[model samples]
Target: MRAAVYRGVNDVRVETVPVPAIGPDEVLIRVAACGICGTDLKKIHTGSHSAPRIFGHETAGTIAAVGERVQGFSVGDRVMVFHHIPCGHCYYCRKKTFAQCEVYKKVGCTAGFEPSGGGFAEYVRVMDWIVRRGLVKIPDGVPFEQAAFVEPVNTCFKAVRNLALEPDETVLVIGQGPIGILLASLAAQTGAKVLTSDLFPERHRIAAEFGLRHPIDAGKEDVVAVAHAASEGRGADAVILAVGGNALIKTAMNAARPGGRVLLFAQTQHGDAVIDPADICMEEKSLIGSYSASEEIQDEGAALVFDGYRNGFDLTRLVSHRFSLEDAVAAIELASNPGPDSMKIFIEPNLAQV
Candidate 1:
């Protein structure tokens, strides 16, 4: 099988590798389509993970073979595989913090090497735990590209749910990237008026299709000022910082009304971000952070993805580019250096099918 093996930081190359051998407790999937994620890009750019591994994880495919012990799944079944699943008995799991569960911290899928997300290859092995509870069956008529969004959709939905949005509230989503669009769209689904900010006009145009009526071009005007105007001179009821930057933290805080919530949706990398204590103390603003997908809301997230598929919230519109497995290097490059024209970029191992 051909896999894009990450050799080192800034280096990934297509190489012929052995097809992963699955145990009786696992299954093999013929890769169909995998979305390039921002997290994946961060891993590649920062050398956060070791080399000689496959990295793509936003994946969907047809089951090639099911293990002898695996039940309720068979060859030819279309599925979206979750690379991580939490053990329900753990302390973190008991508290509903699935991403922090010791078991959940382990990667449950791999191509041929140490278990990392192995979706950037021709075939991948799905471990037993994920097969039982983390796999989602893609409904008939939904494209692989759409199915590939399930995990990401779960993350976005989790963030929106964490906001505890009220119907009368107004939301300001900072950024218009694919994840940002997902965040804004999901926030709007809760009946909140949604506003978006982006430097790229093209991204703003795409966001309009997602029911966003207010778009503030951060390049041209003050985002805080625009958000306040949209919120009827007070400020947004809640500001979701979907793009990562220390500078944007203050912007999010300033754009929220007194006592309003500011959700940090993208400060994934570990670092200290300087924030104004006055925003939290004097104004009584709440600054919170949400990360990863939640097992408790796994079913709800899957249903939301299906709802998006049926109600014209089609996620396929976010996919701006697709490349075959042979050209994964190019796909990674484009996803890394996103411009106004690019949103979700995918690597389709089987382009003919997707």
Candidate 2:
């Protein structure tokens, strides 16, 4: 099997590796489509997250082989894999903070090294825990490309659930990347007036197509002022920082209303971010950080993804380019490049089928 192994910073190679063998309670998935995520780029660029890692978490495929003990799944069944599932009895899990769970910290599913997701390969071994609790069956009509979106959409759904959005409130979503656009769309569904902020005109234009009423270009206009005017001088009722840059945190805080909530949907890696605690305390504003998805929300998220596609979400528009597994490096390069046109890039492990 050919797998794109992460060697080091800015280095990824497609090399022939032994096909992964499934355990008695596991299953083997023949990879179909894997999405190149922002986290993968961050790991490659910053060296904050290292290599010799197979780092694709958003993936969809067909079951190539099912382990002896595996049930309700068989060869040729379409599926989407989630690499992490929390132990529901843990302290963090009990508090609904699944990402913080000890079991969740250790990746449960993989094709190779470090238990990081290995969807870049032609085959991945879905571990027993995940097979029993995390794997989702893709409906017959849904395409693999769309099913690959389940994991990412799950993460955004978790953030939306945390927001507890009010019907009459307004939401300002910073950054109009794939995840940002999804956030805007979901926030709009909650009856909130959605305002999208991004430097790229294409992204803002796409936000309009996603039902965002107000799209502001942060590069040319003042985001804080636009948000203020949209909310009748009170500023946005809530702000979601979908971009991970340190500077965006401050912008999100400033754009939110006095008693509003600010959700940090990204910024997973640690860094010094300058923020004023006084504003949070005095204004009675709350700053919350959301990371990863949970088993509790996975079913709902998957249902939403299926429903979104059936109801004309046009998620395929988010995918701007597709590359084969052999061109995995090129895919990563395109994803890393900050461009107005590039949104989501997909790597088809089974290029022959596509």
Native-referenced Cα lDDT, model 2: 0.87
The parts of candidate 1 lying over 4 Å away from their true place are 352-354
TM-scores vs. true structure, each candidate = 0.98, 0.97
- In terms of lDDT, model 1 sits at 0.91
Residue range 47-136, candidate 1, lDDT tens digits: 999888899899899999989999989899999989989999988888888888999999999997888899999999999999999888
Q: Which candidate wins on lDDT?
A: 1
lDDT on C-alpha atoms for all candidate structures: 0.91, 0.87
lDDT of 2 by residue, 38-76 (tens): 887888787765568788889899999998989999999
Q: Least accurate stretch of 10 residues (summed lDDT) in model 1?
A: 345-354
